[model samples]
Target: MKVGYEFSKESCEDPVMKGELLLLSSVMFLLYVVSGCPERCHCHSFSKSVDCSQQGLVEIPSDLPPQTLTLHLQDNEIHQLPAFAFRSVPQLITLNLSNNSLSTLDPGAFHGLQHLKVLNLTQNSLHSLENRLFHSLPQLRELDLSSNNISHLPTSLDKPWENLTVFAVQQNQLQQLDRTLLESMPSVRLLFLKNNLWKCNCHLLGLKLWMEKFIYKGGVTDGITCASPDTWRGKDLLKIPHELYQPCPSPPDQVPSPAPQPGSARGAAPSLPEDRSALAECELKAKPRPANLRYAIATFIVTAVVCGIVGLMMLVATIYGCAYAAVTAQGHGGPLAPTNQPGKTAGKELLDSPAA
Candidate 1:
């Protein structure tokens, strides 16, 4: 009776264990079916992370894991990016939408990603960007807009791209950049402007002066050439390195006229002479003044010394020639006054002499 009871209890526990194992297996299979990515996107999921980049996606896909923080959609045919394409990624820190066909970025496109950093939009077809397009991403930093077709920048842009550093806008079509655009970005360093059609003009006077005043220099030195007006084409602006936008100078031949007011002193006068004088003073102060007449005098002295040395050499040669002539004259005195012997001529007797 005891053995029968023990066998029955063992049978009941074995069936319960088998049932629990079956239930666990079924739950695992269901989870795999639900969380796994579809066939279109070649995704690899491990534990709680997913990687779905370079899958030839035309648009931002739906049904991505909500906990995914790293989204890499590089090298695709994604042309138009919806405003809320990244809205669901709350924890996303790194977003790479590089090497795509993104032409324009609608304002407020990058929203809901407060912690996002390091946005790379390199190698795209982007031409123009709105001023407030990046208004929402205040915390964004390290933006790379290299190798794009961007031409213009907002003149009145005064926002802090918060904690921003390393702004690269190389290989673009930027014609002009306002010097004031760099005033608000005090924290920014290392601005790249290579390979662009920079139009240097009177407006660029501000940049030229700014770089001189603060002892700061830019990186696009020789590459910043003039593009417009048909005169400055193919000419590098920095090669001249001269200040362009200075106060207008008076005509060289024009004379200063008295002030229109009768009793006005020169202090209050604003004639072209005063303006030109002010400009001259500013130029002298800004750039080092050229060496004065002393340099010319020294150069003249050196030339005179060289000429004097050459003349001395010629005089010495003349003296040597005269001495040689005098010695020859003494040697053939009077041509050995007609040799007494009829057989020997005067020239032949002198030639046959011991000295000869």
Candidate 2:
């Protein structure tokens, strides 16, 4: 009985010790993961978020945990992003790199972030972007690029961003946006476009047309004010009348004119009358002043003419009224003069009879 009791106690103690060892191992593993975080960064185990912001990092860290889902690297001194910068953290979903001095980015800077959804790059010095810079981020949804010095967007993209929803480019030096670039992001609902040096000419007419449709479809955007073509300065791009765009010269067809055959009569009149007509049409189109200025002048002239006609009509009416009033007074005055004279004479005769 004593041996049995001792053996049972030992059996219970062994399971208890194994349980203690398992818990100890888990704690050590947790500590290892926490210690594995890159220097100057705080890693959150449960949320898989890493914060390295304000660290004065001159470049992106290469030792990011593979499971990191969010990264904050804002307010750093990072100046450029090399290709595959985030390849070690392929699962990153949110990357905040705002307020950095980033002026250059390799075409593949964002190559392996397949799950990244949000990217904040506001207040950078990026002047331009490569067409294929964002090709790897198929799931990107929100891209903030405000307060940069970007002058233009890529005319075309490698692929359409079907999931992109919010895009901001406000306070930039943008002169115009490519209509095809906007069309590529069909799911975009919000656009930030204020404070740009918009050039409201034929180059921007396509964007104006696209904006109309985008607004009608419930998309929201701030005003885009024009900064060039003195006539359109300070005017809203969307408010400019479509008629103002009509004077823009249409792009000439790419069909090359047949080079005159070798030794063909030098300076010979063009054989085809159509060629002469087309050339004349192009010259005429090119020499016209801006359509809006012409439209304004025409409007002003028409208004002035109409106002003059109205003033003349009013003056004529006033003259006719005065003449009619004078004629009416004269016609009635003749009858009133005789009627009052008879009354005055009868009153004098009645007074004389009373005296007699």
Which window of 10 residues has the lowest lDDT sum in candidate 2?
A: 279-288
lDDT of 2 by residue, 248-311 (tens): 4543453356678888898785465555435323211123445597889999999999999999
Q: How many backbone clashes can be found in candidate 2? A: 0
List the pairs of residues colliding in candidate 2: none
Cα deviation of 247, candidate 1, in Å:
6.2
Model 1, position 189, has a per-residue lDDT of 58
Misplaced by over 4 Å in model 2 are 1-31, 250-356
Pairs in steric clash, model 1: none
lDDT by residue (tens digit), candidate 1, 178-296: 76765655556556667777666555666556544333543222235666535566666555456433453554445466556866775775556445544333221234545688998
- Native-to-model Cα distance after best TM-score fit, residue 258 in candidate 2, in Å: 17
Worst 10 residues of 1 by lDDT: 277-286
